[model samples]
Target chain A: MTSHPPAGTPSGIVLEHVTKRFGRTEVLTDISAVLPPGRIYGLLGANGVGKTTLMSLVCNHTFRSGGTVLIDGEDPAENPVVLGRTCFIREDQPYNDAFKVRDVLSAVSWFYPDWDAALAERLADRFHLPHRTTCKKLSRGQRSALAIVISLASRAAYTFLDEPYLGLDPSARGIFYDELLLAYSEHPRTIVMSTHLIDEAAGLLEEVLVLHEGRIVLRADADEARTSAFVARGLDSAVTALVGHREVLSERRLGSILSVTVRGARTADDESRARAANIALEAASLQELVAAIGIGGIGGVDTESFTTQRTSR
Target chain B: MTYARRSLRLYLANRSYVTLIPGGILVIMLAMSLVIGVAIGMATEFPLSAQIQEGMRENNGGAVYSIPGFLISLGALAVNRNFAMALAFGSTRRHFWLGTLMGFGLTSGATAASAVVLLALEKATNHWFFGVYAFDVAALGKGDYVLTFASVFVLAVLSLALGALFGTAYRAFGTKGALLTGLAAAVLVVAVTLLSASNKEIVGSWLGALGVWAAVVVAAIAAAISIAGSYAANRLARL
Candidate 1:
């Protein structure tokens, strides 16, 4: 039972030459991109790849070591007007030990102008959050649920969720997906969510941004990303012949059976060629693309072909 | 202004701690004085010495106890996890810092007011009718109340500001740096205490010479620490 805001005030985020370094460790290096408004942008990446750091910089939760961040055309740092329209709920959000679940909801209501108490209550009930329970006493899943409730109920124009489903079970995750889409449909806003459950969350994303080793490797339409590449398997000669000159993201061989993940769209001609060569053509899932991209085996393929918008800015 | 309003609400939410802890301490001290005075009154009485009688007549207690209220406020402000969460929920660092300052300001004000009220009560009741003082220490009665309040208020504010500065340093520099900073502060405090103890006559003479103006010096210290604290919070704090 998801409720939406009466009116929308969406905001877009722009990062220009953003670089973040902690002490001597450079986390995000000169990464730049424009995340457009009123869409669900998935921030996909493996561990320690600066996905969380990038989100922190855009939300002004952490200061950027270099470059500039503009939220709705204004800097978010110390700017209350811009900050009021943004919410960044992280996986390990530290709530005061003394605060109860109800206290957190009450406090957040004051921070976001468009906050919906009714929606928060509904989400809390659905998530089985005990209003009287202190935040420190909550289970891991309950903590995640509380974070989700805050992110959705705040109704901020620019919402960033860094692994908002860390401890959520499949059923709770399903609720998150359902409620997310329902809320977005009724009150559209820009939402950037980072998650490791790629295939499960792929359907909810309008656009996908894949980060590998602190750099955005691919930024493409979610659907297109799913079909961006395909697996070719058959005899070694046939598979090799079919995958020639194309980027091979990954390759595996067993005896005479050869399989390779090629980077390109699946066309009728390619399908016919695979058929004639007695090869199997299987479309690569977004999960596989993420896995392949993270491991640095794009098969010498031009990433521009997969991404609708590149992050060379 | 909206952020200001947000911070105000945040400050208000934690109002109980600002009032209760100091108020409770004052009550407990008053009760202890009453119990001790009654037990002594029941004991066998001999001819008391002039100095002992004077001591009993002017005895004041718990004047310094209310200072911990600053640490209570600091515990809420410094090293507090809620500030980080508040930022994630959409508060700017400026808002959090301002809200904390407002909260500490109110805490100090309430503590000072409480001290004044207790002082008046002690004076009216002749030190709780048992020759004991719970708030008007050093026989500094109605005429000196304002100076006493100012001194207490300054110390309270300084403690709160130091807490904020320490918390910011901890967040910006991690646990090791925070520990080192804490150690440095502790060492500095210990060194000052030892120096003052070793030069008690000089320190006492100097303090006596300053008279009520000593509170003014403390006020300046408070102001400087608070300004530095706000700067640290605004520039160095991270979520």
Candidate 2:
């Protein structure tokens, strides 16, 4: 039931039936997904989903209620050797008040043996954080910039960005995206970024993991997932006949007409079938697919994020 | 160049540490205390050695330590209550503790240096260097309060170690933890104060300050355990 990793590289992340409970509430239940090395994977889900929990679990920031996490084929929990290769930049990072911005960089430099100080300095210039601004005085946007700068510059093989742009303005976000892409291209690694702005970040992702109610509802190539699900717009009867014995992700009715999101192939047969029925066929975007699954009750209010198990390729 | 860059980055980014807001209250309080401490010593015409001796008497045979126990409680609260401040660019728990200790040591050194300078100046002026605390004994033996000196040294070390341990715990546990720890410390301080007279006599009279050192020894051990456990817990749960 699991996908194996490609040859010649370590699986960046592997989670098998991982479960996390916060007191009486089960935040993540039996989650199992693999994220292979050298891919930009987008972890998309709505609020209150276990996206952060799963990411935290993989990064060894939080203890797992159940299941095993293997980073570079080693347990990440309290294991310095493994953790050194991973950078989990939290949504709200804490810094000591007595420290200056430069001093902060100095300390983190020693944590990772392979840290790129030059890249960090270059990114620091890009972010334009005033050299003298104490962390407390920084604007919300600046704080987000600091987080982005560190995650990208740290050059950790396994990097997790938990809502890296929560407070960034569009221009600043664009800078973040550009820096991230440029860095990734130069030094490819496994990047699992959990975000709400799916459409805005659509192009940056190579794969998408859609979570619904603590379970993955969709995991495929960004193009494949879209290609797999097609929207067929036609009369109610025609749409009904076309979707026969296939998965209907979502359906909408206006007067006697219908817009049905049916799980089908982006292949020739599926297209010809729609054309033959005289129904307009269009490929679904990641956002549309996510919305359809989330709102269609495929998963309840507390849907978890798409967790990844790493493969070499 | 690397060190320069790191320190610069840390200083620029560490806004949270800015809470050492050079405010009126803190400034006035520190200034007033210094003034009072110096002024009282001058007016009374007491010997500095005599004052250290009084602390020795106060503890019976306990150590002559001068670390305001209140500071330990303050450190615990400071690190944890303002964690977001700590989490900023420059402040991590480890570095914060290190910097704070350095700052404290420098201040204490300055105090000692000033005392020495003033003593030299006094001798030049043909006056004895006055001390604030005078070690007086109604019935305690001469030569020195052996237990008192031992007690002060032991308590200073104990309090410093406890400060680091509790400070870390307070940070990991946050506001509620800090408050709880602070309250417990205050309660203990009061209890210790209440029992000081009799406890000092018992330890000083025969056992000497060794018994008090034993108590500090036990406390230091407990603090070590707490600190280690908290660090492990943070690693296990922090995301």
Instruction: Evaluate candidate 2 and give its CAPRI docking class based on DockQ.
Output: incorrect
lDDT of each: 0.75, 0.60
Per-residue accuracy of model 1 over A145-263 as CA lDDT, tens digit each? 99999999989888888898888999999999998998888789999999999999999999998877666778888998888888888999988877777777767789999877777
CA deviation > 4 Å runs, candidate 1:
A1-11, A235-237, A253-257, A276-278, A297-313, B39-61, B69-73, B76-79, B139-143, B183-210
lDDT of 1 at A224: 85
Computed on C-alpha atoms, the DockQ of candidate 2 is: 0.22
lDDT of 2 by residue, B46-116 (tens): 44346543553354221122243543453344434333332222223334343444433333333333333
The most accurate candidate by lDDT is 1
In angstroms, the error of model 2 at B82 is 10
List candidate 2 segments past 4 Å from native. A1-9, A97-103, A234-237, A253-257, A266-278, A299-313, B1-239
Give the TM-score of chain A, superposed on the true chain A, for all candidates in the order listed: 0.89, 0.83
lDDT of 1 by residue, B1-239 (tens): 65756766766676677656665566776677666656665672333334543565466435555465556355436446667776887787777777767767777777677778877887787666656545665533323688667766665677667766667766766677567767876786798789989999998888789876665575556557555754564567676
DockQ of 1: 0.75
